[model samples]
Target: MDDTSNQEAYDRIARIAQEVFDMPVVLITFMDGHRQWFKSHLGTDRRENTPDQSFCRVPIATGKTTVVENALGDDRFCGLNDVVDGPGLRFYAGAPLMTHDGFAVGTLCLFDIKQRSFAPEQVRMLEDLAALVMIQVKSDRDIGRVDPLTRLPNRIQFLLSLQDMVRADPGRTCWIVLVDVIDNRNANDVIGALGIDFYNEQVRHAATILKRHLPGNTVYHVGGAYLAFMLDGAQDTPHALIEQLDTDLREPLVTSRGIPSALNPCFGIRSAGLMEMSSPDVLRTVLSAAREARLSERLFATYNSDHDDAQKRMYSLLSDLPEALRSQKQLYLVYQPRIDVASRRCIAAEALLRWNHPIWGPVSPAELFPLVDKTGLIHEVTDWVMRNVLRQIAAWKAAGIDLTVSFNISSKNLFEDDLVSRLSEVLDATGVDPKRLEIEVVEDMNLDNSHIAFSRLSAIRDLGITVAIDDFGSGYSNLAYLLSLPATTLKIDRSLVAQALTDHNAAVTVPTVIKLGHDLGYHMVAEGVELPETFEQLRQWGCDEVQGYLFGRPMEPKAFESWLAASNKALLASA
Candidate 1:
């Protein structure tokens, strides 16, 4: 009713009724809760009035044509404000705009200041007009209900239909299944490489496959690249349908340009009694499950409340992180001392990010970084960490403390075009030596783009800044590729260190990696060296540096300065 087209249609109908009935005022009104909202008023300037002040309410309430020859003579309407006040309407006639379900949602009515008799033929004509109004209303609604591209019912219609089903049989059990045809990253890649037309073709192809597989089921384009449908829990199982759909989707979809693209669909399913959940809640639950499927690399996943709650918390944390970065107290860095194996002296430290969320208490980097890595905000977060770390280094340098600091950067950040320039600007601004700071690039980066990564790292290294291959021996660590990288150090992953003494393969692999890193003319650092035996083993392997709780856990800047002083004093005393 708020749509301009709907308003225009109602206005045209109201004008026709006023001219045909020879009435002074004509209105198309709908009863909305406690108020009567006028969709169209030909003679009156008022937009809405209370139901008690409306003549249309009578026909809507009765679900039939209502006629009052004289409002002043009728006990039912004589005391009404519109009747007793100025412009005193005496003749009133209304025909209920009843839906197909036999409920009157509104009314088309005529009013006159002068008392007049309404003939039976004139009453019939008003009812006919009311029917026409209903038809137009439904036509507009149906148009809104469909997806323009696929010609299928969209999320709006799906929610409406689901609500209707729940109302009809609250106890009925059903399964809501959602399929993500392709993830956002892949969808963007396809659209960027090919074009929107090809992407639309892919969506249409997926819709066609879904319709063919499900046959009688109605598949809805609930979201971008997402298709959803519901199944009766008693009559059908989504497993078989999901399997068939998955198999079909695996086959490449050929576009008009004959380029073949795979859908790579994942499914999320939630089964519950309709009475147990609202329509929107059910859809949201299934969507969370779909995201879980994609994250876990599964073909399908069932809804889990625990995972859903955790995901919600993650999103809340992500939302709060930008503000937290700006605040002085919420976000801070802690330094874990890196000890040189030969001198057993504190030489450098790694700057680790920490967040003390006001609401969530403390957020771990493990939990926060994975989510941040998936977004563009990773760049902002990386820049924040770099700037803070550089400032801390400047403070330490000014205080006559000779210490180097390193910070981790995401794989995405390593390939950033302006990474070198950004670092150079921050370094110059802080008056910190480039050699005093190190950039840690994780080894698990996509090697397929190794050439770009190599060039970016080389550019950074040309600035006289040290680059270290972090989390070595974990992820895709190609020795040949590792040799080609412009990195000066290799930090062994904690997993291998944690399992080295206990696992046979790790025991052999640990020393081999340390020796290989040294042979490549790279400094070797072992992380997670908790046990004294582990530290001794790495020291014997000629590892250049070691960082773990065995030395000191990550500490604030002041605490790190104190710890470094105490360690230096101890070294002098021991000497």
Candidate 2:
């Protein structure tokens, strides 16, 4: 009834009826309980009337053509306002709009001020017109509910069904499950390698498997590679179904094109009372759980509100991060002093990113960077840090403080073709000496693209910037691979530093790594040194720099400057 196409089609039929039967008025209407709603009205200004006063209601009730040759002569409708006072008198003819399931919901009708007889032939033609209207209605409904590819109910239909179920039994519990046949990345890879046809075949194959497993259940094609279905919480065991699917999906899927493909299917399930959540929210919650399963490499994951809430907060941070970078508000940098081991002087600091979210209070870099690494925004984040750090260096230079500041970047940034050039541009713009800036690359980065990473680091070194291998001993540590890089500094990982104080093997290995780095002509820095004894041990082992809470926690620029001044004074007095 809300569809304009339906109204336009009904209007066309109404006009045709008015011209054919030579009636003064024609109407297409639906019996809506208390009133008859006019979908199309011609040759008259009336929009609606009470069901008792409508000629269409009789056809809707009888499921056949209804006619009143003269309402003034008919005892039933003679007292109606249209016959008694409004239109004076009326001749009515209407045909019931019967659905395929044999239910009459509305009618197509004609009216005249003069008494006239509706011939049997004319009544049959009106019924055919009503059938045409039903045809359009059925097509519109199907187009909205059915998925073009899978021929199953679409997401819209799924939501509607869920709503209907909730309305019928608000307190009933149900399990909603989403199956991800393959991740987007692998799906794109397949599309690029073979074609969309092959990819679509895989989706269809997945749908077939789902339907075969859960007979009599409506499966929805919710996404490109996602199929979802709901099960009665009391009747069906979701875990048993999950286990069966896990075993079945482990087998390789061979497409019609004879290409064998491995399917890494993950399931996300949520069981909730119908009244507890809305349909859309249920889908979202299950989707989040499914994503978590894929990320954690699990066969299935049930919805956990804590995990879901954290995921939501993570997404919120990612969305807000770009604006924070642009405004420089909320996002700022703190520097942790890296002390010269022998001289006891602050020679450099590591610039770490911090976010004081207006609502979330403070977001940890530990939580932020992992999420950022998965998106293209990593480049924007890296660029923001680089530009801001350079500007801070220039500001410190203007204040007569010369300190080398280093910042970290993700492994993905190493493959960016323009990374060095962008850094060069920012360096030139800030007018800070390249010698004062350092780039710290993580040690455990995926080395599958080592050539590109090494080349990028080499270019940075050639540009007069220091390159440091960060988190050393935390990842695969190969001496030959380390020697092949152009980096001039190696920062011992905090985990190794912390263990060196307690573990016998770590204590022996820490000094060995420091000696190895020094022998290779690379400056060695020990991280997470929170004790005087750890500092003295590193100093004795010829570690060039030490950075940890023992020296000072990460601080704002002004606080760092004050701490540096006080530290230098203490060093001068001790000397």
Model 2 lDDT tens row, 1-575 = 55355567778888888888898888888777797878888988878888887767677888889889988888878888888896776798888888777989888888888989878898888888888878877777778888888998888888888887888888888888999888775787789999999887877878888899989899999878889999888876588888888778767877888998877889999887865445477787888889889999898899999998997899899998888888857889999999998778899999999999988999999998888988999999999999999999999999999999999998889989999999999999999999999999886546434888888888999899999988888867767556788889999998889888789989999999998898888999999999888888888888999999999999999999999999989989988
TM-score of every prediction relative to native: 0.81, 0.77
On TM-score, the leading prediction is: 1
Q: Give the TM-score of candidate 1.
A: 0.81
| Winner by lDDT | 1
As a whole number from 0 to 100, the lDDT of residue 557 in candidate 2 is 95
